[model samples]
Target: MVAGDGQGKNIDDLPDEIILNVFSFFSFNELIDTAQNVCVRWKRLAHDPVLWRDKEYIIRGRAQNGRSCCGVTCSECAHCRCEKTDREVLRTAGSMPQLRTLTMMRGTRARILRKICRNCPNLTTLQLHGCQKMNYSLLKYIFEKCPKIEKLIIANNLLADRRYAELVSRLEHLQSLEVFENRRGAGPVLLRFLADACPKLREINLSWDYHPLEDVEYFVKAKRDTLTSATVRWTMAGKRCVVTVLKEAASSLEKLQLHLFDVAPEEEAATFADLGELHNLRELHCNQLCPHRPRLISLAFQPGRLPLLQRLHLPHATGLPDDAVATICRGCPALRELRLIFATSLTDGALAEIHRLKHLQILDLSGCSGLGGCAMAHVAQLPALRTLLLQYIDDLTELQPSLRHVLDLEQLRCLNILNSGHIRAVPFEEFAVRLVNLRELHVTYEEEDEVFYKNVFAEMQSQMPRLRIINTFRWTEDDFLTDYETDDDGDDGDDDIGY
Candidate 1:
C-alpha cells in the first residue's frame, strides 16, 4: 500500500522491512528527513543501522578520533532545512553499532568522536585532512579509546603533548602512520616508542629537525637499524637542508633525502657504513656541502661502492671535481635523475661525462651560477632528458644566449627558473610564442616598470596557452632608478682625475 506522497497509496500501512525498502528509495540526504515523518514502524525501519553505512569522513582527525561522525541532526533548522531531525548524528550512528571506516572534514563538537570509538570498537581505516580545531585531547581520548586502528594519516596539527609516544605505543596493532613533524622535543621518544611497541613497523618518516652536525652522526649510529624510509629536514644559515636517514631497521626502505649539509671537511672521509648496510638503497639526496677539502664524492664513491644506488641529488654542490662526476657516471652506469643545484664551481667540461647514465631523465641545474651558455648547450644534448630546472643561472646574463641553447628541451614538460632575473635580455615574446607545448613554467625577472609586467601578462596569455600553472615572478629592488650626475659638469673638459 503506497501512501499519498504522490505514489498514491498507504506505504506506512506495509510491513516494517518493506517500509524500509520503500524508504531506501530516497537518497541518504532525503532519508534523514523522510525518516522523521513516517509512522513509528516506518521510522524505525528508515533509521535502521545498515542505512548509515560508511559515512564519508572528511576529517583530518586521528585514525582513532573516537568521535561519532555526525552533523547537528537539526531538522527544519536554518543551518539544515529539514522537518525536525534529531539534533545529533551520534544517535543515528550509535543505533548502527557496526561503523568501521570514518573520514572527517571538521570537528566543533566535544568527545563526540570518543563516543563513536567507545561504541564502534571494530573501526579500522581513518583519514583526517582539515580538522584544525580538533584538539589533542580528542586525539589522546581516541588513542586510549580505539585500540585496534590500522591505517592512520594525520596532517597539519600542532597537538604537542607529553605522552604522545606513550599513547602511540599503546596502539599495539598500528601500521602505516604518517605523522607531521613534532613542533616540540617529543618526537624522539615517539620514535623510541614506535620502535619498541610497533615491532613490525615497515615505513617510518621522522623529522630529523635541527640536529647539530655533530649529533646527526650520533642519531644515525643509534637508529641505523630501525629507520626504513626517513627524511631529516632542517635549516642551516637560512638555507633549506633535507637529510634522509635509511638503512637496516627499515630493511625495505626505498627513498632517502639529506639536504644541504657542510659535510665536506678536509679529513679522512667520513663513514657511511650504515648506508652501505641497507643493500636496498635506491635514492640518496644531499644538498650543498662545504668545500673540496673534505670531498663528499671521495667519501662515498671509492672505486665501486654504493652499487645499489641509482638516483642522486648533489644539488648546489661545491668542491666536487669534474673527475668525480666522471667517475660516478662511469661507475654507476644505471644512474638517473642527477641534480646539480647551485654548482658554483662546476663547468660545462664536467658534464662531458654525462654519457654514463643509461636511463637519465631529470637534470636540475638550478642556481648553477657559473654554468653559462656553453654548459647549458651541452646539457641540451642529453637524448633522454625530460624535466630541466635552470633557475638563476646569472652566468647566462644574455637572454637568447641560453634560450636558443635549450632548443632540445622538446621532451621537457616541466621547467622552473623563477627569479632568473636575467630574462631582460631574452625576447619574452618569442619564448611565449615558441614553447606552446610547455606545460609548467616558473620563470621570473626583475623590473620597476609596470608596463613590462602588462606586456608579460599579455605575452603569457598569447604564448603558452596550454600552461597549467604559471609560478608568479617579481622584480624586487630592480624597480628603482640610479642617477649619476654632478653639480660641476662644466669643468669636465680638462680636469685632473680627482677633480
Candidate 2:
C-alpha cells in the first residue's frame, strides 16, 4: 500500500475525544477564559460535559497587585474588591450539568449557593470556607435542592445558633461532615438529630470555638458505633467530656486528632490513658496548649497500644526527649510517616533509633536543632523511605554521605532541604546523577549564590530528565533577627519566610 503525504497535521485535525481530553487538563478559569476563545472546535470541547464533571469556584477579593487577597476583608485593605457578582460566577456553574464536586472559598453568599443547588443536582461533595453571611434558611434551601450531598465541609463561617444542626439533620445521606470555627454553637437537639437522622455518617471533624462539651459528648455517644474518624478540639473545661467521648468511640474509631488547651499534668495523663482503649486506631495527631511533655509522648507509645498505628504527627512537640523517640521507633514498627517538627530535643541518638522503623516512608524533623549529618546515615537504611523534609535544621552541613545513601533507594522521590544554611553546591553535584526517580527537590541558598545554584540545577537537569528542582533563596538574617528581638515574649512574628 502506498502512503499519502501526512507531513503537516494541525491540532484542530485531532478527534473530538482527544481534543476534549486535552481540554480536561486546563483549569476551569483557563477553559472559560482562554480555551473557549480559540476557535469553534476548541470552544465546543472546552464546554464538554467531561470537562465540567468536577468544578471549583474560588471567589477571592482582588488585591492591589492583581492577585487574590486571602482571608482578609476588602474594606480593611487598599486592594480593590472583587467586582465579579455572585450571580455572574454562579451563571458559569449553572451551565454545567454533570458537576459532582464543588468547592467555594471566601465571600460566598446564600443566593450563590442556591443557584448552585438549583443547577448542579448531582453534587456529592460541597465545601464552603470563610463565608461571611450564611443563614439557616439558605442552608435549608440547599439541603432541599441537593439531596445527594454525601460530603460537606463548612469552615470559618458565621452560622447562627442551632442552624448547623438543623442543616446537617436534613442531609440524611451525609457520610462526612467537617465544621471548623463556626461562630454559633449547636445544642443537644442538633446532636440527637444527627445521631438519629444520619445513620450513614462515618467521619466528623469539629475544631476551634465549638459548642459545650456535654453536647459534643452526646453527639459522639450517639454515633459511636458507626463513626470511624473523628477530630475534636476543646478547652480545659471540656477535658473530661473529650475523654468520655474517646472511650466510647475507641472500639470503632480508626483515626483521631485531639487538641486540648490549658490542660494540667493530671488531666493530660488521664487523657493519655484513654488512648490505650483505641486498639483499632491507625493514625494519631496530638497538639497541646502547653509545652510538649515527655510523659505524654511515653504514654502514647506504650507497648501494644495503637498497634495498628501507621502515622503520627506531633507538630508542637518541642523538646521531645531521646528516650521517647526511641520508644516510638520500637513500639510503632509499622509506622510509615513520623512528623516531629520543632521537636528541639531530638539528637543523633533518636535518629539512630529511627532505623528500627523499617516501614517508614516519610520522615519530617524540620526545626530539630540537634540533628546533624550523622542522622542522615540512619535515614539511608529505610528500604521504603521516599519523602524526606529537613527544613530549618541549622546544623545539617554534610550531605555527601546522606546523598550516597538516598541514591540507592529507588522509591525516594521528594527531598526537601530548605533553610539548611551550611549545604554547598559540590556534594549535591556528586550524587545528582544517581537520583533517576527524583521528582521534586527543594534546596536553600543565599541571595548571592543564586547564579551558582541555577547553573548546578541546569547541569542536574541534563542527567535526570524528570527532576523538578525548587530553589528557595534566603532572606537577610537581619530580617529574622529583628523580628525575633522585637517579639520579646517569644511569639512567632507576622513575617513568613517559607516563600
Candidate 3:
C-alpha cells in the first residue's frame, strides 16, 4: 500500500502509448537513467524498442558562441572548439538500441565502440571520418553487426589497416561507399571480391587517397555497371596512373579531384586528355601545381575546357603575402564557390580578383594569411561575395585594425571566422556585435582549441540577435592524430593549421 510498493498508482495512471511517447522525447542517456529508476512503471516503459527508433545521430559541428550583450548578440567566443563535449554526447547516444543513423568522426575513442556497434543492430547509415583510432577488427565488427548498412563512409587517415579487406568483403549489401586514402594491398583480394560481390553499389569515392600506382590499377580493374560515380585522388608524381582510371572507370565517372600538392607530374598528356574526356563528369577539382611547374597550371587552364564543371575547388592554403590570390583568381571565372585555404600566397589583391567574377556565391578564406582588414576592406566593396570562410589562419593577429575593415561586408550573409586565432581579440568581439545583417556566422575551434570561443560568443550574443543557424567543427591534424587526452598541450600550439 506504500507509494513505492508494487501496487502503486504509477502503472494504473498512464496507458502504454503515452508512456512510450514520453520516453521517446528524451535522449538516449536520459532514457537510460530514467529506465533504471525505482519506479516500476517507468522501468516497464523503457523496454519498448519503438521509443528509440526515432533517435538520429549527427556529428556536432562548431556552433556560434551564445553570448548576448544588453539585447545584442556578440560574434566571438572563447570555447569554439566543442570537441570534448561533442564526443561525450556521441558516446552516450550509442546506448540507444534502435539507432538508425550514426556519425562518429574526429578521433572517436574505441573504448565502448564495440558496445555501440553491437547494440545498434538496425543501423542503416554510418559515417566514420578522421577517427584515427578506428582499427581493422573494430571495423569488421561494425560491418558484421550492422548488416543493414546501406551507406558507409570511412575516410581520412594516412595509416592503412587491414580492415579494408574485411569491410569491402562485407559491403555486399552496401549501395554506396565513401573512402579517403585507405591502404588495402595485401588484405586478401577484397577489391576483386567487391567488384563481383557488391553488384548493387552505385558510388565509390577514392578521392583524397594517397595511393600507389599498383593499388590504383587494382581499383580501376573493378568494373561494375552499377558504378555511376568514382572519385580519384592523385598527385602529379602518380600522374601515369590516370590512364588506368580513365581507361577502366572514366566512362561512368561523375566526380574527380586531381589535386597537385608537394608533388610533380609523372604523366602529362594522357592525364589531361583523360580529364577532358570524362564527358559524363559534372564536377572536377584541379589544383595549381605546388612545385615550380607552371606548365601543369597551363594544362588545367587550356583554352575552353571542363564545360560540365558545376563546382570548382582551388587551393589557396594560407598567407597572401603581397596578394598572390589576385593572380590565382584569374584562372576560374566559372566557379560558383571558392575555398582559399591558408596557402600564404594571397593578399587583398587575391580578394580583389574574386570580386571580378560575378558567379562566386560561397568563399572560404579560412587560413589565407595576411588577409586581414586591408584585404577585406577592399572586398567589402564587392557586390557578389555572399559567404566567407575564415578558420585557423594564425597570421590574422591584427584583427582590430581589420575589424573596422571586415564589418564593411554588410552584404555578406554567412561569415565564418571560426578559428582565426591570430586575429586580435578586441575587434573580433566587436564585429560579432555589429554584424547584425549577418544571417549565419561561425567562430570555430576544435577540442583543444577551446580557449576563446565562449568569451567571443558571449560578447557576440549581446550584439547580433537575429542569427538563425550556426555550425562549427575541429578540422586540424591534432583532432585526428595525437590523442586528445594524451597530449592536450602537445600542438606547441600550431597544427592542421596545415598550410
Against the true structure, candidate 2 has what lDDT? 0.66
Tens digits of lDDT, candidate 1, 216-257: 444444545554555555332223222333333345556666
Q: Pick the candidate with the highest TM-score.
A: 2
Candidate with more favorable, higher TM-score: 1 or 3: 3
Go through the candidates in order and give each one's C-alpha lDDT. Answer: 0.53, 0.66, 0.54
Better by lDDT, candidate 2 or 1: 2
Q: Is 1 or 2 the stronger prediction by TM-score? A: 2
Q: Across residues 1-499, which tens digit of lDDT does each residue of candidate 2 receive?
A: 2224566666666789887777777765667668877887777777677676555444443222113233333333322222244556655755554566665544455456567788878777777644334555556667788888898887534222455666677787899887766444422223566766777898987655545677667777888888898877634234444755667888889898777545555566666666666888889887742433565756767778877889998886775777878888887888999998888777778877787888999989888777655677788788888898888866555444453566666678988888877667225675565666688988887778889878888988888778888876444432121110011121123221111
Q: Write the per-residue lDDT of candidate 3 for residues 295-407, one digit (tens) a residue.
A: 34434433344444446565653322333344334544556676656556655555665565566677776666655566666655555667877777665555445456666
Model 2 pairs in collision:
none
Best by lDDT: 2
